[model samples]
Target: MHLRALPLDRAPVRLRQWVFLVDADERAAEAAFVALFAPGQDPGLGRALVADDGGGWLWERHQEFSTWTWFAFGPLGSELGFEAQPAETFFWLYGAPGEVFRGVEISVSAPEAQPPSEVALSRHIDLHRCVSCEVFDGAARIWTDFRLREGGTGRIHVANHSLAHDEVSRLVQTLLEIGNYRKLALIGFPPARELLAWLDGAEGRLASITSGLATGEDSQAVLDQLLALSAEVELRAAKNQFRRGATESYHRLTLDRLEALRERRVPGHSTMSEFIARRLLPAMRTREAADRRLDDLSVRIARSGDLLRTKLGLAQDRQNQETLRGMDASLQLQTKLQGLVEGLSIFAVGYYVLGLLGYLLKPWLHGWPGGAEIVLSGLVPLVLVVAAASLHRRKKRLIAGRD
Candidate 1:
């Protein structure tokens, strides 16, 4: 839902706002919001604003983190009351729902007769790292060191000149958003840095695996290594996927807020854009590089797997061909043995038939004994030829049936 608009009658002379990055789930954060600001009221819209005696409370819930802003305003000479309030003051009163990631303190004041010197600013922030710029086309000036103090809060000072109260509220809101998103984006940095060394080692391992595949090393072993590497890579990617995506989103929003400021740089001093370019942009790039590397590694792993599978398939085909050849040889030998056995059977049958004929013709051929012997010798070739022809025909019929 949308943020509730602020009701401002006039520009505040002095304002102090505290921005907190709450680390909690949506349910717990909403509960905390209701408890801290509107007891018995639901923040179904994800944002709420509450006004009290000379102060206001605004809280918004986001996907990865939530922000709570507390602001107080008073007359120009009125002493700003929140300077003594520590970062834990809110948690102590409302019962902390979650840990805080980033805390920012913003103070707005009327332009002084004399601007604070660099020496005075140095007491609160590093003078060398301080950033100052005119924003809203010189309607106001902003200063900050972007450094956390002992209370774990970064400070921003805005000097108001001609802006209305509503404009100042919008400006503060933008400033708080920039800080919140910047810190949220940085959540990806540490993990990315940790992954740098891991990515280096993983890349080397992948290279070695690829080399082994190219060199025709053991296919199964190489495949196992690739699978293991893929699993590890996926695990790491899954763990950091949300953070990387969130970082990119937050980075873009931070840039948008900086642009919304319409900053004009102060002479001899860096602006917020320059400060972010020097600090946050590099971290964003590092994370982007890690994401690209992870993707590249996955692609290479897939390619290696495909290559290994092709090799395995070729090797299996070769083995199959060899097996077929051996089977063919064995079949040929069996055919030859079957032919020899058929020929022997034919000769055996002929010999038995000759003995029977001899017994039958004994009476008639009592005076011609050599006749039977010559007849039997002539019929021997005929019987063998007939037997061979019959076996060939039978074999042909069997083969035809199989086909």
Candidate 2:
């Protein structure tokens, strides 16, 4: 949709279908072209090395979606709509090499937010509420038609559904003072009773559609749709405004840091070198802010997982140490049990040997007690050894537990 880009004093890029121009001085234009619309920076979709076809550049500097669109200048008074054929040698300028003019056409129509009735179509030219996808099936056109005329610096247009009387008038007045609009016009229907009075005050050919078939009429319905679309756009813009403030604050600090580093350019650290080292991270940070919030969140989650894993490892290590101590204690208990079994075998062997010796000595010691003494000596040594081993095992277990 071709509307005008008016001065800031006027309403900002208003409505769904309009264009406005910037009356930049040569220097301003040059600076804007150099700083904002650098060549090879594709304006559509993503970075695919686009060039300039500079009739004039549209530096769309919204808070979030910053972009530049280059256009080809046409002769004054040329028909400002789609043409069947495009001129071969249209003027073009671009930063990228081997990219000149490409023929594209633009069209503008009045707002027809709803299906036009037979009667309404007969009376007035049916304007589409906005451009459709069908219009740019091939290459798209850069639509710019609103320009300054009659020495009017800029123009402000309050759309057909614009309400808020005091606010609208204030904005209109601001647009006038700021040299924003060339011809400001408020297109709307006042309240019916007020509109009747307004129409009575109207001179020849009052420029308004005040009287209509109430809100149910197709035109009114279309107007409603357009206003709703415009409002949604405005709300999105308002939300972006807050984001822009935060972004600007962050970048402003970053640039300030860069300037400080530049001032401290040392013997070894070249300015370029410093920029490469310090500025690169911040630039990456900026890009991440714009495009990688989810990625950043993912990174944060991963870091959190790592921390948890570390904590779990520490706990697991402590549990393992306790397990090792328990195993050591169990080994000591098993060793003691084995030793006790061996000692029992040794005692049985000793008792059997002593018993056999007594049997042998019984006939020789018929009047002696040497056989009994031998048995008692062997048994006492065995009992003392068993008791000492048990005490040693209990002490070892106590030490292991303390350790």
Candidate 3:
């Protein structure tokens, strides 16, 4: 829904906004919205509802936070003050949902002939830490310390010179966004800081593992270490992915809103843009460095795994070569044994054949003496030749059939 300015009266308006960090449950946020509005009313992304007395509240739901802007026309000639209680106190009293992260009270008034003195501004804001500037091309002057009071709400006082109600509304909305998104962006800082030590340790461990791989450490042991480190890194990345991404997004939005203000410097005071940059940029840089470290660790772990795999592959190749050599030696021995067995078999068959011939010759030799002996002696070589030839032909047939 579009952002609409609060209905303006002759008197200036005072706006109070509370931003809450809600649970991830959409239904819970919706339930909270419905409780605040009419029954069965859905809390979409943005909604504006007004009361009969010309006062209303704007509601907006963000990724993990929601903002409630309440505005009412101020009385005539009212001085800038923080007499009202903080938004969190009121929410706590009425049981508002979610935890409050930021609260801002903005007072917009008609231009005055004289600007508030330092002492006067100090009554509401800490002048020592405040930012004062003219925004919207000098159409309005804004002053804020960006410091939370005892009640946990920041204060901003604006003096309108020639701006209409719509400009004022847009201005206030942008200002609120700057604060809300700035707080949301800082949420990643603590986790990022906590990860610094962890990242250091992980990097050192990875370096050691890499060195071991270089020095011919056990492949299986190195692989185990790499796997364990990779698991822990992946688990951490999965857990932090959402928050880190959100932080980056919110930080960008904060910068955009600050730029949109088109701020001009006030003498002796910093502009809102400068103030935020000074405070927020360092934290964002820290987060970016942490993310880079995580990525670097992942790459190193993958390289280590590749090294281990290569080492194992080479070892397996060597083992296969040894086994092949053993098989070759065994085959050579078997071939020699087969040749010896074939020669012995040929001799055995020849001896058996010669004896049978002699037995048959004994009956025929009844009429001859040396003739049988001579014939048998001559048959011995011929029988051996026939047996060798027969064995050789059978072996050739078997080999041919196999081929």
Candidate 4:
């Protein structure tokens, strides 16, 4: 509440004034204020400053822009008489952060049925076609071409209904805001046009990728293409989000200001609402459409990527099943070979045992006379059976451990 009530003064124009807000930062604006006012002159200052020259300057510092109102009340405006405005005094205005984004030249007067003389208006404004309206319950009537003159200035004529200083100042601020917000809103237009063209190309690429997907031609290649396209679309969307949002905010505010103007139709010109809507609304719509299209492209690309990945996954699953089946058949062959090897091992072991037993019997039989041979064939069956049983039990234990 306190900050809102902070001093916001327009130029001290008794019956006429023009105001300006340029794209300037705080440092440049403060420098401009100092340059306009002699050092230590007046010795009183705050966020607002009054130049020491015949016409004073109102310094307003805002976050993104600044307003420097150069007025001699009714003469010697710095911007209008560009050459006449002293270099040393107004040089700081050159250091502004950027070029002028908004400008307004207004004439305010006491209650009068007749409008102000066109003599001064003609110097800057094209008086032939003007938009005029009564506002604040007919407290004032303002006229304008809503155009930048050859000198790059906007003009307004206000026939005052005996407004006080604060009232006139508020009116000045509102008018200035209208022009500023409208410009900001429309800034998105050219970019949107360019973006639309870019989007067309992207859509074309997406179509190609989608077509490939439909044909089932090289799923890997199509999936790669989809991934690339999705990345590009997402990047574009990320970059545009801020621009889209700013334009939307500016559009909403510009319309809100128009509402506050409470404009009525003039005799020969369109109201502010009508004029801005014709140009700005469509631009905004184009921008909106572009934004929505970007989002849609992103979503479609994501879906396409998912579909391709699912197809690839299913293919991999089928291949894995075939691999598992091959392994199972190989395992059965190995099991039969292992049983045959175990049988051979048992036969060889039993033969070797029977041979050793035959030698022992020969020793026993020959002990009586040292001449008879002994046969061990009768023990072969038992040896073979015992060896087979032992080898089979060992194989069972090994197989059990493995399982």
Candidate 5:
């Protein structure tokens, strides 16, 4: 992952946007060269040869991940040269694309007998002092980096093989002293701890999310962790900033108090106003990026929590409404059943009364029927009414259950 983007005021010049890691045969005299010139496709700005000191160049280029596949071209007709050997030296590329022309990289692995001094020496050698040089006949490799920036800020780096053992601390401190984005320099050995610390401490704080070999985990995981760490770091940093500011203010106040006491020596010192802005506040309040970041993250988290709470409340409200509707439906079915029960009771009473009347009539007309005939007719109506009521009750229950 990449570091946080530099702030507008602190943006570094886009110079050495590309970085190269290389290994070559010790016998090779010609240093390997990696560069970008634009408009590269055209005869553009010719070529600006950037010296390789300890700090490399920074440039502006577009890229996806930090890794890339690159095709090295051979020069003209020379099959073994850089231009002709397109397939000979295939390697992974990193950083921005070809748009950045901030600087260039040249690597040469040479024997002790033929040191870097011998390689870079030319008729113009006296005119252009090489910022860095190295010679390794046996196992040692010389790596250098350069920095170039506005003002006269820049640096040169030269060292032997085995990057792990090199004096990186001195190199970094020196670069920081120069305080220029253009300070070209070199660093070698697989990416290491010193480099990580230097990068994190320099410029703006590494973005809230960043990854490198030093972080020890895969890039994605490292990025996630770094983001979390960034939040805490920013908050802490902001608090620290305020603390420092207050301390400075206190110091200034003490100074003012001392100055006021000294005024007793003057004849008419009492005529002057006791307050002094400069004494009370020695410096302007500088905004820390870390503080801004913390605020942004807090706002985002708060908004997210609010949105989730609203959604949950709405869901619960909807569920309660559904329950209320169900309860209403059940009450309506119960009311209908109650009315049917009352109607059935009335029907039963009326049938009984009709049966009694029929029984009495049977006595009035004795030749018409036996007592059994009167009983059968009255019982039929009672049985039919009861059956109808049962059917209605069953239908109501089924409908209620469906609901």
Candidate 6:
């Protein structure tokens, strides 16, 4: 029996895949997976796992989500009535503790259906309202409506002509991965859209605040607003930091997976790679635009802050200069008053010395007559000069002591 990853399909074989969209909690998903698949078994599937339980199992865990794939070996009847049949693991999958993002059903017609009649294949998928394309170098053809069918799951049909066992698995993997990554990449679109509106208002406010810079308007208020704007921008950046990064990573994965398909052109259809690149680029561009806008607004805010601070500093400097001028005038007035006080003190000190000298020399003057009077007159003038010199010497001594 052809079982698990090494199924040998010499005859026409049918391969069906049901890829369910999973929540972002990898841990919780892994736990539920362990309880279901490995219960009392390996429990540690690591990242990628391949096993057999009446079918092939492909389980992969990523940072933000996980995927579980089960393929049954058998024939799908009459389009499987277009009814997607869940495998034995269906209940476990649905019961898995994660929110469904999207689920897809892939049905591959076996090698006998190789190079399926284009017209027939197209009509086969037409009932499903799908988009059709041929790939695998004319060895295989694919059809998908990309619409949620019976179980909110999109459908894809692959008719294999000459693909090897490994090639089949790899092809399925690449296609499924392309779908997964593409979905994850666009996850940032909604947040980016919402952020753009907020950014527009922030930029407008910043522009208004910046215009104030030209005309020194309400500097304090302007500074306050600038601070607020800075906080707002920073908050937005912090909030979307992971989302933006995830978008870029997922976008890259989407492209990589699409390229891995090695898609070949079918006469009248487009390759998945081309289709994805066309639509994915614009979403990525939107993310890019949002990022660029954030950075631009941040730069503008910083410049505004710098300009505001410079203006404030200049204003403070001007105020300080005015204050210094008033202080200088006050200092000059004090100097003049001090000079007058010093002059009066010198005169008063000289007068007191003369009075004491006259008293002491009165007896001698009476004896010397005119000679005594002349000597006393000259001595009085010399006494005043001595008083001034002594005061100057004392002032120098006091200053020297302080130093």
**Best-performing candidate as measured by lDDT:** 3
Against the reference, the lDDT scores of all candidates come to 0.74, 0.35, 0.80, 0.67, 0.34, 0.71
Q: What is the number of backbone collisions in each predicted candidate, taken in the order shown?
A: 0, 18, 0, 1, 44, 1
All candidates: TM-score: 0.81, 0.26, 0.86, 0.79, 0.27, 0.81
Evaluated at residue 326, the lDDT of candidate 5 is 99
* Greater-TM-score candidate between 2 and 6: 6
Give the Å shift of residue 298 in candidate 1: 2.5
> Native-vs-model 6 lDDT?
0.71
lDDT of 3 by residue, 1-403 (tens): 4444444443367778888777876546555654566444455534435454656666666668767777776641334645664545344325657777888888777544356666766788887778999999998889999878755789998878767647877888788889888988999999999888899999999999989989988888888889999999999899889998999999999999999999999999999999999999999999999988998889888888887888899999999999999999999999999999999999999999999999999789868868888899999899999999999999999999999
| Model 1 alpha-carbon miss at residue 372, Å | 9.2
lDDT of 4: 0.67
Candidate 4 or 2, higher TM-score: 4
- Best of the two (3, 4) by lDDT: 3
Using TM-score as the measure, the top candidate is 3
- Residue pairs of candidate 1 with colliding backbone atoms: none
Model 4 weakest 10-residue run by lDDT: 75-84
Tens-place lDDT per residue, model 4, 250-279, is: 789888878887777767767778878887
lDDT of 6 by residue, 212-323 (tens): 8787689988988899999989999999999999999999888877666667776555667777778889889999999999999999898888888899999999999999
CA RMSD of each candidate after superposition? 4.1, 25.0, 3.4, 5.0, 21.5, 4.5
Clashing residue pairs in candidate 3 (N, C-alpha, C atoms within 3 angstroms): none
lDDT score of model 5? 0.34
Per residue, candidate 5 scores C-alpha lDDT tens digits across 210-321 of 2232343354454455455546545554545544444344444444433322222213222111222222222222222333444555454444335445555776899999
RMSD of 6: 4.5
